[model samples]
Every structure is written in structure tokens, then in C-alpha cells.
Target: MHSDGNRKATIARHRVRLAACALLAAAAVLAGCERGSQIGAGESTGGPSGCPAVLAGAQAAVSRAEKKEVFWNGPTTGPAAAPGKTIVYVAQTMTNPGVAGAANGVREAARVIGWNVRVIDGGGTPAGIQAAMSQAVAVRPSGIVVGGFDPDSTSQQVSRADAAGIPLVGWHAVAAPGPSRRPELFTNVTTRVEDVAGISARWIIAHSHGRAGVVVITDASIPFARHKSDLIRKELATCSGVELLAYENIPIPDASSRTPQVIASLLSRFRSRWTHSVAINDLYFADAAAAFRAAGEKGSGPPFNIGAGDGDPSAFQRIDDRLYQAATVPEPLSQQGWQIVDEFNRAFSGRPASGYVAPVHITTAGNSDGATTWDPAGYREAYRRIWGK
Candidate 1:
């Protein structure tokens, strides 16, 4: 009887061990099944689960796009205060539309990046610019943005600014031999003046059927005048019988001596002989276009081709009135200011302080169904998508 009882007890112990082994295997299978479902879902959704590295980079790029109406490339965004930083923008340009346009860009850029800006209008004199820069430097601002100023007069101020550890940026134009001028003050942004000139010349040539003439009105004091004037001549050189009748430079605030009518009269004389006409920037074309229309000459002389470098509302109005023809380049002043702010934000965030060019294009009545103007609002949503919204 004792031997039989011992055998039964051993069988019972074996049965319990077998049951525990079966339960352990089932739990392992269920856990593995749950894990597999999670992996599969993450892959399908392309969310946090499937490819985390790729998703993270894509999200970052999307944030960089902003809400501003873009005239140039890239959306404008309100960057959170990345780091403690302060910057001062100094245009220091006297009454020049090009400078004004640049200032507008700088202002917009500042608003985006959250920086302070100090605008100084530098009359067509080096002394004035020097004084303006000196005053700005005295405050020891983080950085200064100058609009194509010749630093000769501002040498002392620039040197002082460097000593004080302030950085400088040039907008629109930089001093000649710019590299040597201010190693400390590097980086400049200007619309592609040559590109605009090329477009102007080509439009004239196209409108004239290869017969064209040029009358470039410019401000001799501004750096843009000579550089752009040279480009006009170069591009016109590409077409036969296309000639520059006169390259005139009229000073701002002194247009009284050379009224738009007077300039127009000068151009009119050449128009009778040549089939086309053009100007260096907005003022030139606006005035010339007015002169031609007031004279009751519509398409009378070579399509009255003119190129406006900055697309101001007044310029567009003139275009709408059919007082002007040819193409106008859109350099939204507000958008430029916003880009400056964007760059500043990057620098403050310890990213590259690399300079960037905001892309621009030629806007004409043809592009907008003969509207003869650019209303950025029509494409605001699209602009926001690229620039910021």
C-alpha cells in the first residue's frame, strides 16, 4: 500500500509542471502578436512609429515656412525667441526708392525675427552717411544694415563699430572691392539689377520686332545707376539696331531742374528716331511713360518699353493707366523686411549667418491678363504657402 501511494504522488507532480509550461508559451505568443500589430500600424501611418527620423526632418522644414505674402521665395514665419539677441538695422539711405525698398525689406525681416531697426536716410553725400552711421554705432547695436553706402566717409565709424564688436550687413549695394572695404562688414543683398536690365532690354527688343532704342534715366549718385546702366548697355548690345539713345541720371529732390516733362522731351526727340525706350528703375519709367501718354503717343514709338526695378503701387497705377509698357519686377518691400528678420533669427539661434537672396520675378500685364499691375493680394494664400501664412 505504501509503494502505490508514492507512485500516485509522483504522477500528480508531473501533471502540474506540464500545465505551467503550456501557460508560459501562450503568454509569449500573445505578447509578440501585440508588438507586431503596433509595428505594422506605425509603418502604415508614417507617423511617430514607422520612420521617426524622416518624419522629424519633414516637420522641421514645414515650420520654417511662414505666413507672410511672399514676393520672394520662402514663407515668412514668426520664429519663437530662439536666444537672447538684439540687432539694429541701418539703411542710411537718403531719398532713393531702391534704398526705400531695401529698408522695407529690412523692416519686414526684423518683424519676423524680433529685432530693432533704425532707419537713417543718407542724402547723396558721404558726409551725411558717415554721420548717420556714427550715431547708430554710438549706441553699440548688435549689428547694422547699410544700404549700398560708400564707407569712405564712415570709415571711422565702421572701425569704431568693429572695435565695439558690432557686425554689419550691406543691403542693395556694397562698397567697390567690397571684400577689402570692410571684412567686418560683409554680406549684402540687392535685387539682381543686371537681370532686370536684361529683361528690360529684351522686352524692348521683342516689342519693337528687333528695332529698339534706349534712354536710361538714373540717379548718378546711387551705386545702382552705374552698375545697372552698364548692364542695360550690355544687354542691348545683344540685339541689332538696338541702341541706347541717352543714359540720363537725374538727382532726387532736385528733379525740379529736370522735370519729368523735360526728361520726356529729351526722350521724345530720340523716340522719333528710335523705336524703343527704357529706364533704369521706377522713377525713370514712370516719368517717361507719363510724358509719352501726355503727348498722346500710344505705342507711337517702339512700344514705349520700360523696366521698373521695384514694383511700387504708383508704378503699377501708371502701368494700369497704360502710361507705361514692358515689364515690372516685383520686389515687395514689405517681404524683404521680413526676410531680414528671418536671417537674423537664424543667426541668433546659432545657425549659419549665411546670406540669402530672395527670389524675384518680372510681373507684367500679360502675366495678370493685361491688368498692367501686380496686386499681391490675389495670390496671398499661395505666397503664404511659400513665404509664410
Candidate 2:
């Protein structure tokens, strides 16, 4: 009777152990499926799960970009101003602060350089941009500034300009800044998009301590803007804990109307999970602020925001006030504007492009010192001296 009892007890214990093992296996499979679902929509499996190494590197990079005292290291020697030259600025839209800011710089420089400058607004449409480019080419200006729009979209106009020997310069018009052979730009004026993208992503990583649920906003209509957002997405993926919650595509023209609605939807769906946001341009945050306020989000934010490029005055104000935007990787719009005019001077004198790319900088309220724009020092004087004005 004792042996039969011992055998029955042993069988019962073995069955319980088997049941526990089966339950663990089922949990493991379910967890993997959940991860698989997350990854199907642009999630990353790279980097260490906790991202200790990545977090340290990101913190260091953000430290470098946040410095306030930046000096200009642009071309000090170039052809003196090509005087009396007429240049027309073909704008993507005057409403875009970056474009207008750069245009203002061009006017400032042109006044010193003794050149005539005209602006033709593109209205932020392909047709509108093409019309502007056509008008610019028809006016037969000494040069054409492709301000904040793709040159390829207006290929015929670009080709016409090239054929007519009118030098073309682009501001935020290409992926990389410098001379291009295929699209045929004298040089593109802007910060390196990769640097902009990386630092913005690193800002989020450092700010969040490697754990964040991020939403990336971009305008898919412009090639430069689209490429910038794509780079931002890739950099965000470097930290395994930084989950990309959504990639929103709201065109710049439609942003004012569309962004509020989109932000409402995102808030409803993601709620507390969306811990941070980044946009290719700062204006999205401008549009998003109202929606956030309506939903009772704080003037400060759980979804701390950053703009990847084009640090306009409004963006700086937003950062300084801490009204939803925390930081910006601002292009020296005014400096780049001066650079654009200088590049045209070089082109007119039959010289090669200046090959000067601005260093990336990040602006936050603590570092802003009540400034409304990120206008670095010394570039204006440097360009003036080069132009011998």
C-alpha cells in the first residue's frame, strides 16, 4: 500500500511541472508575436535592448549641439562682388519662415554687394513653383535662387536656365549641400541633413534616457523634407527602447488645417504612450500646439517636441516660451542666405562653389538667451569682407 501511494504522488508532481513548462512556452510565443507586430511598421530590432551604449553616445552628441557660442568658419576668400548683377529669388512660399528669412538675408547681402534682387513666390505647389521658376527664367536674371523647392519638379525650367548659362543656386533644395551635376545647382545652401537628423534623434534619446515612444512628422511633398524625415526615422531606430509610434505625413501648405486634426487623432490613439515628437520643420509644432492645449496638455509637455531643421523666429519663440517645442536643430537661415549670395558671386566670376556647410546647432530655452532666431555671429561680416563691400 505504501509503494502504490508513492508512485501516485510522483505522477501528480510530474504533471504539474509539465503544465508550468507549457504555460511558459505559450507566453514566450505570445511575446514574440507582439514584438513582431510592432516591427512590421518601421520598428527597430537593432541596438542593445536597454541601449546603455547608445544612450551614452547620444548624450555626448546632444551636449555638443547645445553650445551657444558658435563661431563662423565660412569662406573668407572668394571673388569680390559681381556688381550690378540681377538675381531673382524663386520662393517655394513666402509664408515659409525659412524661405523668407533666407530671402531677407539675400536682400541684406545684395544691398551691400550692389545687386538687384527680385522675389517670385511659388505658393508651395508644384504648378506654382514651376510657374515661379518659369517667370524667373523668362526674366533672364543673372542667377536664379531655387528657394525651398525641388529643382527636378521644374526640370524644364532648370534645363532652360542651364542652357542659357544662368547660374542656379538652391536653398534647402537638395539632399546634400554642395554642387550637383545631374540637377545642376551651383551649390545648395543648408546644414547637412544627416547631421540635422542625427542630432535631433539623439536629443530625444538623451532627453528620454533611451526610453521613448516617438512620433515623427514630415511633409512628403518636398524631396528635401522627405529625405530629412527618412533620416530622422533611421536614427530613431538606433535605440531599441525608442519606439516609433507613428510617421505623420502632413504637407506644409495643408499643415494649419490638417495638423490640428491629426494631433487630435494621435492624442486619442496613443495618449500617454506618445512621449516625444520631432518634425522636419518647426511649423508643425506651431500647428500642433492648439490641439494639445484643447486636450489639456500642459504648456510644458510629456511629448516634448523638436524641429529637425529651419529654425525660424516662431520656432525660437516657441522654444524660449516652452510652448510644446523644447528644442530645434536650426539652419542658420540668414547665414545661409548670405552664403547663397556669396555662392552666386563666385559663380558669376567663374569660380567653383564655396563648399561651406554650416555646423549643426541645437537651441533650447535655457540656452536661447531670449533670442528669437539662431543667427550665428561673424558670417555676415565674413561674407562682406569676401565681397570687398
Candidate 3:
């Protein structure tokens, strides 16, 4: 009886061991299947799965419009000005490099045309802009140029200028979807905000191979920033595999202090899934890239960053170093400044102001080795010839 019991116990133990091994094999197969499903979920054996058609369409559209230049072919002689006549430029802020560059362009053109020019610093505040506009009207300059000031805040002053028969020209001032409602506004020299956002989105998608999980950093205080953010959201919606993990609107005042925190928080939360960062401009992208490096996240395949406008020098350096920045779409800021002068000249001459679409170009680490901004082909000569400088 004891021998028989031992034999039965040994058989039962073997049976249990065989069952456990089978279960382990089953679990391994199940795990492998799960991984396979994940890998194939948004990709194909042939190529990327999500939004292939959309990607191709975007590429075609960009290709169709790539590097198309617009030049001013109006009368060579700008409106003749009396020796003492003056032009007033209401700068957004002299402190801003881009605004300062525009001011310089205005100054240069005014110098060539023998017109006195005064630039009032708007101090980047509504009150300052209003004050500047009021002061400009008091002086009764030949014309007025505004650099990215809020039109509504200065509407009354704009009305006053119109009543006083002063032509107002804006550079980088008009928001997207604008021919300013204020009839006093003569024209705006700017690129379509949507186009800038769209091109940037396309670059992200293409470079990431159509699988972009993006974090968009926007500045709500700036109308152009909001416009760019909105358009980027719209474009990315059409892309299937692209997910918008966060749409962070960093107020202009807090951007310097808040950017690092924002980037760190988002990286920690979405490090595995996030693949790109799209910022309103290069300034924010630089901050994000620095934060990424500080956090010890190493590798460059996904989570690339890109931006639009101003082409901050630091951003170009980041791209060169291959830290995280991938590309930047630079608006021809200085050239736009010259265009502002040309438009004002046209208005002063009683000719209809020809609003020129500012040109933009995508600069990568590869293409932007020695450059930080986009200058249209022969832009200097073209403007000089037009202004008869």
C-alpha cells in the first residue's frame, strides 16, 4: 500500500510540472503577439501607416510653392518728400531684435530719401502704444509706421490719424486673415501666418516619418503666435498618427522663467510617446531643447524640435550641435522692413499700396551652416533699386 501511494504521488507531481511549462509557453506567445500588435498598429511592412496620403499631399503642396519669390516692380522713384518732412515709426519695442531691425530698415530708407524720421518706443505695452500714437499724431508726420502693435488698443488714435490724413502702414502688425478693418491702415507687409504654421508642421511630419506626437508651445500674448498655433493644430488634425500631447500657451511675460518647467514636466509625462515639439518661434524651442538635455534624455531619433520666425541664433547652434532642434522657418524680417518702407512710399505717392507677401524659407542644420535668417534672392539690390537709393 505504501509503494502504490508513492507511485501515484510521483505521477501527480510530473503532471503539475508539465502543466506549468505549457502555461509559461502560452504566456510568452501572448506577450510576443501583444508586442507585434503594438509595433504594427501605426506602421506597415511597406512604410508608415498613418496619414501616408496626407503626408504626400502636404509634400506636393510645399514643393509646388517652394522658393517662389515676390519682388516689387512698381515705379522706381518713391514719392518725393520735402526736405523737412518727417516719417514717424512707432516701434513695438527697441529692445526686441526683430523690431529693432525693422526700425533700422525704416531709418535706412528714410535716410536715402532725405526724410527726417523719429522712432518712438512703444515699450511693448498698450498704454505705451497709445501714447506713441497720440504723440505721433501731435507731430503730424508725413506718415506713420507701426511695428506689431495692437490695432484695437490704438483704434481711436488710428482714427485720429485718418482724420488728420496720415497714412498708416504696419509691418508684422496685421494678424492672419487681415486687411485691417481700420481704413486708416494702408497695408501690411507680412507672410500668411497659416502658411508659416503649415510649412513647419509639414517639416515635422516629414522628418519624423509621419509619426509625430507633438507638444506645441504657444505665446498667447502675441496675435501671430496664437494664429500660428491654431493653424498648426488644424494641420496636425489631418495627420493620423500625430498626437497633440499638449498645447501649452506660455504668456510672454512668464516665458523666460516658465519654459524650462513646462518642458521638464511634459518630457517626464510623455517621454515615451512624445516625438516632437513645435513652438511659435525659435526662442521657445531653444528653451525646450536645453531642458531636454538637462534631464539626461539622450538620443535623437524622435522628439525632435522645430520652430518658426526670427531664427534665434541659439536655435541654429542647437541644430548644428544636433541636440534636439531640427529646423526653423524664417520670415524675411529685414526684407519685410524694407517692404514696409516701400508700401508707405507707395501710399504717400497716392498710388494704391501694393501689399507684398513676405517670403519664408525652411532652414535646417544642414542648410543653415552660416546663416540665421532668410533673405530673398537679391533682396538688397532689389530694394535699393526700387527705392532708388
The prediction achieving the highest lDDT against the true structure is: 2
Where in model 3 is the C-alpha error above 4 Å? 1-47, 61-85, 94-97, 176-179, 298-302, 312-314
Report the candidate with higher lDDT, 1 versus 2. Answer: 2
Q: Is candidate 2 or candidate 3 better by TM-score?
A: 2
Ranking by TM-score: 2, 3, 1
Q: Residue 296: error of model 3 in Å?
A: 2.0
RMSD of each: 27.1, 6.1, 7.3
Best by TM-score: 2
| lDDT tens readout by residue for model 3, 100-155 | 66777778766766678899988877787799889999999988987766666788
Give per-residue CA lDDT, model 1, range 70-154, as digits (tens): 4433433333444334565555454556567667656655554445677766665677777778778887776677665555447
Q: Estimate, for each residue in 1-389, the C-alpha lDDT of model 2 and write its tens digit.
A: 99999999999999999999999988765564331123211122232345888988988998888899999877889898887899999999997888999999899888889999999999998999999999999999999999999899999999999999999999998899999987999999989999999999998888877777899999999989999999999998988889999999999989999999999999999876777899999999999999999998875676889999888999999888879898899988888888889999999999999999999999988789998888678988898889888
| Deviating ranges (above 4 Å) for candidate 1 | 1-87, 92-94, 175-183, 253-265, 289-294, 299-303, 368-389
TM-score for each model: 0.67, 0.88, 0.79
Backbone atom clashes (below 3 Å) for every candidate: 25, 0, 1
Worst ten in a row by lDDT for model 2: 35-44
The residue ranges of model 2 lying beyond 4 angstroms of the native Cα positions read 1-49
